[model samples]
Target: MADDKKKKDDEVKKEESEGKKDADETTAASSKKKDDEPKKPDVPPVIAAGLRLERILTVSSPSGGSAPKAAAAGSPHSSDSATHNAAALTANVEAVLHSNPGKIVRRWLGTSSGTSSRATLADLSKGAEALLSHDGPCATGRELVMLLAPPTEGGGEAMDVDAKAGGEEKKDDDEKPKFLSTAAREYEAWLISLAVRLLWRDGRHGDAHSLAGKGVSILSAHMDDAARVTARAGAAGSLGKAGGASGLYPLLSRMHRYQSLAAEGLAGEQGESARAAMRADTAAAHRMACLRRDVDTQATLLNLMLRDLLNANQVEQAQKLLSNSTFPDSASNNQLCRYLYNSGRIQALRLEYTSAFSNLSQCLRKAPTNTGLGFRIAVQRLLVVVQLLMGEIPERNVFFTEGMVAELSPYLKITQAVRRGDLPFFKTTVAQCASRLREDGTYTLISRLAHSVVKAGLRRLNVSYSRISLDDVAHRLGLSCATSAEFVVAKAVRDGVIDATIDHAGGYVRSHDLVDVYATTEPAEAFHRRIAYCLTTHNDAVRGMRYPPDAYKRQLEASRGLKGKKDDDKTDEEKAQEFEEEMDEDY
Candidate 1:
């Protein structure tokens, strides 16, 4: 029995020793494997940017097909899908980074919109967040690029985008790529712009402005590189249409605008100093736009400046801006609508009621009917007020426009008071809706309508009585005194508000007999005016009609072809005629 127990203990100890030996062998093998596997060096930011850009270009390329759709957020496979995407992107980057930056920029700009699809753009942005998250030492675009470009290689004059691979074999001559300084600078500028935009979107306005300024400097460097290339190539004239850096101008202009806007946002809406800074930034952006001949950006900045001035209650400055620099008639409809609206407001303030009404009417007509309900409502409200100030009653349906009845309610009350000649009621309505009027930015303009209210009262009195005492006029029209009432009636008569005469000596006003409209040319003249307006509108619409993309060009090409064919046939006939005449002469 003792020998059996000893044998069992010996067997258990041998089994435990065998298990320990196997575990020791496996651990040694794993440690050896880990040591043998090379560690991945950290990706430099510029190279990483190039990689992301390449991936984006590939996914957005027409021949590349659509990128793999990402799994919905929070799905179990979402993490897996993201991992797979990152791996795929790294593979693409590794495969393509050996090429020069010129090839990469060419590929990038070759895309129709200069950006990838939403999925790929998002992926690239996520990668950018990782690469650009660092704040110090390598902050600017040039610094990032310099890291990838070794100074030993002629101060990065011919910086290739590829990171070093220690053991890679030499590539064939055809496979090897040449470096382009211009392309490298362009790539740097693009990365900076992207970073700045992202920073701004993330509410880091100060950082965004700093990065954008860096981008501007990079763009300047790119322009210098382009000029050098042009001069070396013996290209003539200033950097015009054929300038190598022309493609980067748009990017540069956008950077300027973005930088200015970011700075403005950082300046906040508090002090005069902030406003001055904002204005200075805007002026700088406009000058850049003008230099680049970027008309769209110019128009946009003009409208922005005008809005800023108006919001600051600097009406004179707004007018000077409009007068000093004409708003481009070739601007977009939305921009033109805004310009017209601003011009109308200025005109109203100047008491040029006729011009104000004309501008406001045009603005209302030009404003989009289906969209921009707020814009349409604003223009419509101002239009009604201007019409009243012009001594003309607005049409009843103007107040009840669809999508605007609720907004125009206050204007409707003002209009009712004006048309009814109720001076006291008009005063009450203005007081009650003072806050709303101020909010709509029409308080000052509405104050001028009191004169219109007086004129309305005179018209009512003209219809009601052949003559009335000045004291009665003061009481009925809510005037402060009989002298004020007499002065108002005299001005109204001189302005043709009512066919009445103010008898200052008699201290009363007398109305002329009502004329029959059908017996006069006024009705015919009004009808003719309406017809002319309708015809002009129709003609304008016909001229302004737009064809689908390329449709007009196709039509023009087709017409030219037919005309050429006709000319060819005519030339042949003329040749035959001349040949017959020569034959007759020979005979």
Candidate 2:
């Protein structure tokens, strides 16, 4: 029975071993099948397109702790793939940027109330500095026009010529450098502007101005580039030879208006103390040449500077600014008129009546007809007084200009009262217009015309009577006393308005013999003056006229147009003869 038990145990052991071996083989075959069937693509099968944007967006914690490990474990081989991608992306981004590339910029970047935001802004600024460096393949100054140039015009056909010359090799050589240049140029401008805004916000205005100053060349280039483009393309039709001046106005206006409204609101919110702070800030900004230059806000800067100079009574400095190249050439009609008007006002203040009259007249001529009523009224009001001061009466038609009736009513009364030598009427008119004059801030200036009224009254008195009592003169001219009347007579005598002598002891005025009005040797002095003025005007017109750049192009077009009409009458030789001189200039 023992021998039989042993035999059965051995057989059972062998059967068990066999069963285990079979099970191992079956497991191996199934593993092979799974392996052969493609093991569920462990690493998202290396993408065909190398630059996958999703890689950038994917956030992975550097710490790879329990949770990440757990996640990795769940995905089998996914952790390896993720690690590979992360490494590759880091390498690529590092290679694209500088050795220490710094942080990437975003439009809505905000400070974290920490050092991080500032560091990022610093990084962006550094990048801009790198771009602006001459060593880089960056576009500089007005060369930006190449990027924006019309397809039919500059550089657009360069690609084809390049392709025909060197096929793909030269293209490959040229394209990379070109792309780098463009990327660097764009990044420089954007980063610089970003840095400026950031610095401005952080109360680093000095730094901001310094940085902006460096980019003034680039900003001004944009203006010149735009003007050239517009001129070449005839882009802004009917805007005239003002070039890009009118085009710039709306943009500048909107920017300034928004800033003003914002500042005003801030002052309103913060009250009186804020106003002084705001004014200081404004003054500082206006004085920063770079900030003003970069944004093309120098026109406003110039105006502010002029105001400051005038306030300081630095007339020479203000006049120097007016004559300087730094002064913007008034290209827009509105700007031209305003500039003239301001010049006129300043001259009037300085008692340069002739220059003031000329400037005001130019302003009126350039100003929009039936519009700019306020500007016209202001000019006319000052002009009427200036004319009277110069011993001239403005024509009646001047008061009847379209859209100027109501506005000039007070001025007309003043003019009419002066013309008729009615002293009391003049005084009454001035008193009645006192509120309006004060409102216009011309009360002091208009009051100066009161002396002119006295002069006119004395001249009339001289015409009516060869001699008159000083007391009677005081009564007629509405003077307070006989001493005032003698003073007025002496001034009139000195001015040669009315030939007169003051009898201070007898308290009477005596008039001298009147001379002939037209006693000049040549054509009357007035006629000679008019002739000289005409000659000067002609010379100025000649100096001011400029031929357009596309004059030759227009001539060519004209020639073509006339070819249809003149073809039968003239030979090809005649047309060629006329255009030959122009063609060389064009070339």
Candidate 1 lDDT (Cα, 0 to 1): 0.65
Query: What is the Cα-based lDDT of residue 322 in candidate 1?
Result: 83
Candidate 1 residue-wise lDDT, 36-147, digit = tens: 9999888644445455553554444333422212211211223454454333332322222222323345346445233421213233333333333122111345454333
Q: lDDT per model, in order?
A: 0.65, 0.54
Candidate 1 differs from the real structure by a C-alpha RMSD in angstroms, to one decimal, of 17.0
| Per-residue lDDT of 25 in model 1 | 100
State the lDDT of candidate 2 residue by residue for 238-313, as single tens digits: 1122332222222332233223333333324443443344455445644543332322344554454565455445
Worst 10 residues of 1 by lDDT: 67-76
Query: How good is model 2 by TM-score?
Result: 0.48
Candidate with top lDDT is 1
Off by over 4 Å in 2: 1-250, 257-301, 304-326, 503-507, 520-525, 532-536, 548-587
